[model samples]
Structure formats: C-alpha cells, structure tokens
Target chain A: MSARRGKLWSRTVFLLILVTVAGVVLLPILYFLTISFASNYEAYQFPAKILPTFSYPARLRYNADTENYTLLLKKGADFEAVKTTSDASDFSLYCKSQLNVLISPPAVQTLFDRAKASDQAVPIKLRKDFFRNYVVFFILAEGTMRALFNSLKAAGWTILISLVLGGVTGYILARYKFRFSTTFSTSLLVVRMFPAVALSLPLVVYIMRMNLYDTPFALAIVYSVPNIALTAWITSSIFKGISVELEEAAMVFGATRLKTLRTITLPLAFPAIVASSLYAFLAAWNDSITALIMTNDNPTLALLVYRTVGSSTIPNLPAAGAVVLLIPSLVFTFIIKNYINQLWGKVAL
Target chain B: MSYLKLSSLKKTYPNGVTAVKDIDLEIEKGEFVVLLGPSGCGKTTTLRMLAGLEEVTEGSIVLDGKDITHLPPRQRDISMIFQSYAVWPHMTVAENIAYPLKLRKMDKRAIASKVEEVAKICKIVDYLDRYPAQLSGGQRQRVAVARALAVNSKLSLMDEPLSNLDAKLRVSVRTFLKEIHRNTGATTIFVTHDQAEAMALADRIVVMNEGRVEQVGSTREIYNECGSLFTAQFMGTPPANIQKVALASSRGRLVAAAGGGEGAMPLDLGDRSAFPGMEGLIGNEVFLAVRPENIAIGEPDGVNEASIEIVEPQGAYTILVTRVLGGEWKIMLEGDVDFRIGQKVSLKIDPGKVMFYDAQSTKRISLS
Candidate 1:
C-alpha cells in the first residue's frame, strides 16, 4: 500500500512538471498567435488577451453641451466613454486608427446628424475583420514574397552544400585511420568555435568580387561555413556507429567502393543525414546578422521580419510576419522528427 | 596450375607490426580449406589478403589464372561473409542478395530468380521481404550467406562466420555450411579460431601459430601426427599433456624419467625396438607429449604408480586426473569408469602413440 501511494505521488509530481514545461513553451506562442490576429486598436489593450477577439459592443452619443460626439466602448457589463470627437472626419479617423473599425466620413456625418437630432444614444454595431492584419502585412510590406522565396532558396542551398561536403568528410573520418586524423577532427570543431559574424565581413568582399553579392547563394555560402563543420561533427559519430564491415561486404560482393557507399553506407546513415540537414536549414532560415551583412537588395524573410519590428510601434504587423516566418520551420521540423527519432534508436531502419 | 595460389604472402602494418609472415599456400578448386589458429595468428589477415580487402605488402595472389594482387575487391570475383554477419541493415533479405547481381548488370528478372534460389538454399525464403534488423542474429547470418551465394563467384571466403552464433546454433550452422559447400562445390577459404569447427568443415585444415603456418593436413594427420609442439598443444580440447623428461633404457625396455634425483621413477613405454634411431639419445632430455585418451589406467603393480586426484564424468566419457612424471595428467576412460580420489593406479604410456620433440627446437622427432 505504501509503494502504491508512493508511485501515485511520483506520478502526480511528474504530471505537474510536464504541464508546467508544456505551458512554459506553448503559452508564449499562443499569445503571439493572438497578437498576430489582433488589430491596431486591440494591440494596445491592457492586460492583453491570450485569445483573439473578433468584435466589440459599442455606442455613439452626441453631447449637447460640449457639441461633440462621444464613442462609448463596452467594458465588461458597463460602457466606458473612451474618446470624443467634434467633427465627422475626426470621428471617422479615430475609428479607423484607434478602433480599427472602418467608417467613411459621409457615413459618420449621417450618423452624427441622426444622433444630434434625436436626443438618444445611438448603438454602433461593429465586426472586426480578423485576418486584416495578415492581409495588410502582405499587401503593404515591400518584397515580402520575394524575401520568402529567397529564404527558401538560401536554406535549400545550405542543406545541399553542407550535406554533400560534410557527408563525405564524415565518411572519411569514420573509416580511415590516416596520420593526424584526430588532429584534423579536432580542428573541425575549432572552425565551428569561431563565430560566423567574424567571417561574414571578409566573406562579403570575396562574394562581391565573384559578382555574387546580394544573392541568396552568397548568404548560403556564409551560412554553410559553420554549418558544414557542425554537420561533419554530428555525422561522423553516427557514421562511426555504422559497421565498416557492411561496406566491405558490399565491396566483396562485386560492388565498387562508390557503389557500396551509395547502396549501403549512405542508406544506413540516412537518418543522421536528414537530421544534419535540419540543423543546416534552421541555421540558414533563422539567421539575421549573417544575412544582414551578406545581402543588400535580397534580404531573407528573417531579416525582413527583423526590419519590420524596428519600423512599427504596434506589434501586430511584425507578429503577423513572425508567424509567417515560423510556418516553414515548423513544417521542416515535423518532417524531420521521425528521422531524429530513428537516430535515437527509437525505430530501426 | 593450382586454382588459388598465395606465393610468399606477407602483411606488415604501417606501424611495422607483421601480422602474416611469408605464408605460402595452394588451394585446389572445389576444396573447402579452413585456416585454424588462435587470435592474432594471422589467419584472418591471410584471408583478407586473398579477398583483395588488404593490401599485399611484398606478395602476389593469383586466383584462377588471374594475378589479382592489387585489384580492388569489386574487380576480383570473390564473395566474403564477415564475422559480424554484415547483412546490410537498410535492405531486405531479398534486396541484400540481389544487390550484387544488380551491380554485375544482370537483368532484374534474373537477379530475382537467383535471389530466390539462394534464399531457399539458406532457408531464408520465408524472410525475403524482412529487413536484417528485424531478423535474429542467426537468420541475419543466413542472409549474409545467401547474399554471398547469390553472386556465384569464383571463390568464397568466410571470416569466422559462425563465431557470433550461440553454441548450439554454431554447430548446426557448421553442418549447414559444409552441406552448402558440397552442393555448390565453390572453392572456399574459411578462417576460424575454433579447432572443432575447422575439423568438422575443412577438407584440409591449415593450423597456424604466431604469423606462420605450423602444419596443414587432414584432420586425422593434424590430430595423431602433429608436426610441431605448437600444433600438438593447440589442436585438442584439454590439449595434449606435455612434460620435459630424459629417455632411459631399463629392464630391456625404454622408459622416460622425469626428475633428476633418487626420487625419480621412470614411466614404462614398451620395447626399445619400437623407437628406431632414438637409442643413441637415450640419456638426452626431450619433450614428451601424450593425448589424454592414449594413456591407459590399470591395476597398480609398481610401474608409474600415482594416486588419482580427481574424476570428471562427461556423460559419454569420464576424465580421470592423476600425476604422471611429476605433472598433473588427464586420462580419458570410456563411459563412466568408477574411480575414487587418492586411490593408487598404474599409468601405461602408449609407446606407439607417444610423441617426442626436441626440447630446444620444439619440432617433432621421427621415431621410425
């Protein structure tokens, strides 16, 4: 009975810890998603909403003594007079900028005349266009689609370059026992230790001399510098776990060394290769400073999103951009998760 | 010309350690030859050199009239089963067998048929579609065998293929491999450290020690007529009982005396005429080796009297342990012969079966 109770106590503690960790990770993303869907007015709401709001109950009233129109917004059960405007255009502008509720000046003037003639408060019913922030971000932002394409191209090239060069280096390091192999392997880590920013300045000059400046390929070249070393480090250990006799068996069975690598070694090391590609992709996809120095007219989406955050005080536009930036990374990670699981020995290939 | 010939095969690593030193062997076609040795005896190195997996440092290998000393493994028509049973984990059993055929540019239909044929022979046909990781170690070993057999190469090499299996599985696989060899009739060179596996499988066994071949012969010759002290000591379970003794003639018979003093009692070894040309060296010290089964236990009379120290019943045969010539010696008696500990017994050394070697050189001495 004591053992059972102890087991139950441990399970309860484990569950509490699991929930805390999940909330810590997921709650911020949920709040960010709500902000991405929020309007300019909703962005400034106090105590900020964790869930998106679509519509608000409001009332427009004409004050007789002040000779102005008052906008009353619903706050819980009661109405709060948030703003007052004297003229029709002023009221229209206020609603458009602060409330993010579109109202033409002529329509506002008619409503104001009706409110003044009748001594009663007029009810104003408004529904929010929830996807308006996302639509406006894409429409107003310059070269957003082009930046998205450039980010993809850069990440694609990074994966290609790193996997090809690093995979061959990994195979050689795992198989051969030449002189200074340990020294060579340790030096690859030293190369990774140097920050990519330190290399970007000198690399830009060479990139320009080759007439490849401001291109996604130039950015990929910078991204692949640190990524190749990282990829080689990861893949070499995994390749070591693979048996060398498997390759020798292939060779002894009348397959050439190249053919053996293609049919045997590469397939056996595929999960690690896929995992390395994910690292290479994220490095190129999420980098801003390296792309900042390496590109000019052709900035990647991450750099574009970073620039958007600086230009806007209201975060809705930039939040929308960040969500858009997150989709591809999420998709790639989801696809590569199975391969990573295989690397951890969860599934046999 | 021999089907496969290795002339002066020597392997010296880059660090200047020699694994195989000047090995010369010739194997005829359709013969199953086993290289038997302890670990680091260079048997695997010799097999690897023949398979073109290792570089031939100061040697030449000629296989079926082709000088394939430096050719890569693919260019040489040979198939090898690794000790780890390296059936490709990424491939299904059928794909593993078909891959070599595909590399040879055989048609897809022919490759499929050949895979089916070998899979049936190896009894892995039911698991043709299953990956190697899904199969047990023994089944994966059969997949490796099927893959090697699928190519129908000029030669087949197995490097301790059955070493990874359980003991019972090892014996069954040994018989299965021998049966496969008989059916296929491919010239095979198998490397193993197990003497029983070698004896059970090989048409001729090449016993190796250190980096050189100690002796090569049929099982009976290697067992009863070992050419060197190393072969005699290395070839048997419980091994041969060896002692350093001086031969002396006593009572019109030849005897081997063990210690130097008054306490020394000579073990009787039959007539002097049996050991021709050994009469001149009667007083010279020589090494005497006797198999456990060769020495007979009888009623104590006075010659080579010793007390039985232990008795071990092994289901079919009983091993009786006693002291002979001041060294612990084992005697194999058939079928549970009851013997008590500390009981006095007489040990009769078989004169014809007793082997002698020069103490300095450790080489066998001819008696007749």
Candidate 2:
C-alpha cells in the first residue's frame, strides 16, 4: 500500500512536469498559429485570442410603438447600432460598412421584417472568412513562392555538401591515428564556435567576385561552413562507437579501402548521416542573417518573413509566412528525431 | 618451403610500446595454427600483422613465395573473422556473404550460387535474407564465417572468434570452425587466450608471453614437455604447480627439499633416473614443476606429505588444494575421495612428468 501510494505521488509529479514542459514549448507556437490564421482586423486587436473565431454576434430590436427595427452588431466591447430601418431595403450597405459582412438586400429585408413583427429582440450572426490570411500570404503576397523555393534549394545544397565533406572528415578522424589527429579533430570543433553570420559577411565579397552572389548555391556554401563542422562532430562520435573491426573485416574480405568504406562503414553510420543532414537542413532553412547578407535578388522565405517584421504593421501576413516556413523544418526535424532514436537505441555492432 | 613465413616480424607502436617482439614462425599449407597467450601478450597483434591490418615495424611476411608484409589487406587475399563477429548489420546475410564475391566482379548468378554454397556450409542458409541484427549471436558468428568462406582467400585469420559466445555455444562453434577448416583445408591462424581451445583446434600452438614467443609445438608436446616455465605454468586447467626447491642427495639418493615460507618440509622424490645427467647437480637449487593431475593421494610412505587445506568436488574429479612445500599445492583426485581439511596425506609425484627449470633463467632445464 505504501509503495503504491509512493508510485502515485511520483506519477503525479511526473505528469505535472510533463504538462509544464509541453505548455512551455507549445504556447508560443499555438499563439503564432493563431496569428497566422487571424483576419487583418483581428491581427490589429490588442491582446490576441488563442483561437480564431469565425462569426460575430448580432441583434435586431423592434420598437413596439413605432413598429421600426434597429440592427446592432457586436464589435470589441459594446453593441454597435447600424442605421435605423423603417424600410428593410437599407440594411445591405450599412451592414457591409459597419460589420465588413456582405448581405444581400433581400436577406436584410427579410431579417428586418421578422424583427418588426417580433416584440422581443431577434438574434442573428455574421460569418467571416477563415483562410483569408493564408491566401494573402501565399498567393497574394508578391514573390513569397519564389522565396520558398530558394529556401528549399539552399537547404538541399547545404545537406549535400555538409554530408559529403563532413562525413569523410568524420570517418578519417574516427578511424585513423596520427600525430595531429587529436589536434585536427579539436580544431574542427573550434571552428564551429565562430559565428556563421560573421563568416557570411566576409564571404559575400567572394560570392560577388565569383558572380554567384544572388544564387541559392552561394548561400548554401556560407551555411555549410558551420554546418560541416557540426556534422563532423556528430558523425565522428557515432562512427567511433561502431567498431573498427567491421571495416577491417570488409578489407580482409577482398574489399579495397574505398569499397570497405562504402559498403561497411557508411551504411552502418547512416542514422548519424541523416541526423547530421537534418542539422544542415535546419541551418540553411532557418538562417536569416546569413541569407540576408549573402543574397539580394534570391531571398529565402525565412529572410522575406524576417523582412516583414519591419515593413508590415500587422503581424498576420508575416506570421502566416513563418507558418509556411515551419512545415519543411518540422518534417525534417521529426525524421531526424527518429534517426537519433535509432542511432543510440540499438546495438548494431 | 613453408606456405607462410614471418622472419623477424616485429611490431613497435608510435608511442614506443612493442606489441609483438621478434616473432619468427613458419606455418605449413592447410595447417591450423593457434596463437595462444594471455591478455596483452600480443597474440592478436601477430595475427593482425599477418592479415595486413597492423603494419610491421621490422621483418617481412612471405606468403606462398610472395612478400605481402607491406601490401594492403585486400591485396593480400586474406579473410579474417573478428572477435566481435563484425558481420555487416546493414546487409542481409546473403548480401554480407556476397559483397566480397561481388567486389571480385563476379556475375550475379555466380555470386548467388557461391553465397548459397557458403551459407549452407555455415548453416545460415535460411537466415540469408535476414539482417545481422535479426540473427542470434552464434548465428551471427556463422554468418561471419560464411562471409569469410565466400572469398576462398589464400589465408584465413581468426582473432579470438569464440571469445564472445557462451560456454555451450563456444564449444559448439569451436567444433563448427574446426569442421569448416577440415573441409576447406584453408591455411588458418587462430588467436585465443584459451589453452583448451588451442588444444582443441590447433595443429600447432604458439604460446606467447610479454610480446615474445615462449614455445610453439603440438598439443601433446605442449602438455607433456612444456619448453619453458611460462608454458608449464600457463597451459593447464588448474595450472601446473611451480615452486622453488632445493635438490640434494641424502644417503646416496637425490631428494627434493621445499624452500619457502610456511609448510617447509623435505621430500624424497625417488632417484633421478629420468633426468640422466642431473646427478652432478644434486646440490643445485632449481624450479620444480608438476601437473596437478599427476600428483596422487597415497598412504604415508615418506615421499612428500601435506595436510588437506580444501576439498572441491567437480563431479568427474575432486580437486584437493593442500598445504605442501610451504605453499598451497593443487592435487586432482579422480573420484569421490573421503577427505577432510587439516587431514595429513602423502603425495607421490610422477617422475616422468616432473619438469625442472633453471634457477636463474626460468627456462626449462633439459637434463636429457
């Protein structure tokens, strides 16, 4: 009984911790998503709502003595009265201007007629468009689609270069013993500590000199400078954990050094490679400072979204662009998360 | 000429530690030789040198009349089974076995057939489609063997291949390895710290100690006539008893006297007829070595006597750890013996099996 009580107490504590952590991680994202879906009016509203609401409350009241109807729409705090209608035909333009809601004159006429016949106030509702912000960001916004493609092309190239170059360095560092192997591996990490932005600032001159300044490929090269070092560190530790005997077994079984690496070593280190590629992808996908300095005409989607912070008064379109940018990163991160689980979870050796 | 020769083969690491020091050996074609040693004795290092995995500091490895000491492993045309099995986890059993055959640029149909043939021999045919992660440890071991067998290389080297398996699986795999070797007749060099494994698998056993070869001989020779004090103490289940003893003549016959702390007593071990020229050295201090199995329990007839310190009954044989010669001496009795601690018993040593070593050098003092 005491053990069960203790277990229950611990479980409660663990659940508390879990809920707190999830809340901390998810609240900001939820708010951002809410903003991305917000209408232009709601985006300007102070202290935003957590969920996007589609409809506004309305009421039509009848004065029994005068036999006239009054239409009132709920805005922020108070009920706003539209123009008094003796004839029901005048509700269309007044409804359009006051609520931003389009109603046909015939429907407004019918609503007013019902309110005039009724002794009590009649309740009505107005519906708004839910996907207007998304449409505005993706389709209406100029060059957003092109910027998205630029982000993709840059991320793809970064993954390619980082894996090819860094994987080789990692394999060499893990397998070989030389006079300066320790020094060389430590230097790879030391290079990682230098900021990518600082590197990109100087590299842009070279990119322009090579006439590759506004291309995604040039941006990728700058991003890969830091990404390659990180990929090397991750892959080298993973490769070191895989026994050298596996490689030697391949070599002794009629495989050349290159063949051994291709068949035995690389395949065993695939999880780490995927994980490192995800790092490279994220570095290119999320980087704005490097993208800002590195390109002008070929702006990545992240930079375009970052540029919106200064240019746009409302946050909805920019938040919508950020939501669009988050999808590919989220997908790659999920894959990388799974790969990391597989990396250390099982004993391949 | 021998099929493989290592002349003055040496290995000195960059940090200045010598792993295999001055190893000189020649192995015949189709011979199964075992490098037997304790940990850090450099048996695996010597084997790795042959496989072209480790570089030789000095000397040459000539295989089938061609020097291959400096060649890469793939060019050396050798196959090695690692202690960890080292079967590729990413590849299917068939793919792991077929990789080497494929690298030879063999046709797909031919490679498949070769893979199937080796898989059947290793008894991993049903598991051909499964990855190594799906196989059991012993099955993985067979897959490793099958992978090596697919190559049909000039030489096959194994580095403590059975050390990872459980006792029952180890024995079974040991037999499997021996059977494979017999069927293929591949010139093989196997490394293990296990003396029993060496005796079971080796055509010749090379006993190593402290980076040097102590002795290389057949199982029978290694057991009966250990060439050095190291081998004598190293190559037994309950290792051979070695003690400092003073040999002197008493009443015109040679006798052995214990020279150590505690249980010090003189022993009359009969005449020195087995050691033909040892009469002149009667007063000499020497090393006396005896196999635990060779000492027998006897009535007190005044040879060497000791009180039983402990009795360990291991079903087939009861091991009697006794206090004798100023130290604990192990004696093996064949069956259930009624004995107690602190009970005095006489011990008769087998004259033929009695091995003597030089007092200073610790080398076997060959009197005959």
Which one is best on lDDT?
A: 1
Restricting to chain A, the TM-score for each candidate equals 0.90, 0.84
Instruction: Give the per-residue lDDT digits (tens) of candidate 1, residues B305-354.
Output: 98999999998999988877778888887887888999999987788898
User: What residue pairs are clashing in model 1?
Assistant: none
**For chain B alone, what TM-score does every candidate structure achieve against the true structure?**
0.98, 0.97
lDDT string, candidate 2, A1-349, tens digits: 9999999999999999999999999999999998887766566667888887777688888877786778776667877675677765566665543334567888887887778777777898766656666666666557988999999999999999999999988987887788899888889888778887779888888999999999999999998988888888889998998898888888888888888877778777888898899889998999999888888888999998898766778788788888888988998788678766562214444
What DockQ does each candidate score versus the true complex, computed on alpha carbons?
0.58, 0.48
Model 1 misplaced regions, further than 4 Å: A62-69, A83-96, A100-125, A343-349, B259-264
- Model 2 stretches with alpha carbons more than 4 Å out: A1-20, A45-47, A53-129, A138-141, A177-197, A203-212, A335-338, A342-349, B258-263
TM-score of chain A of 1: 0.90
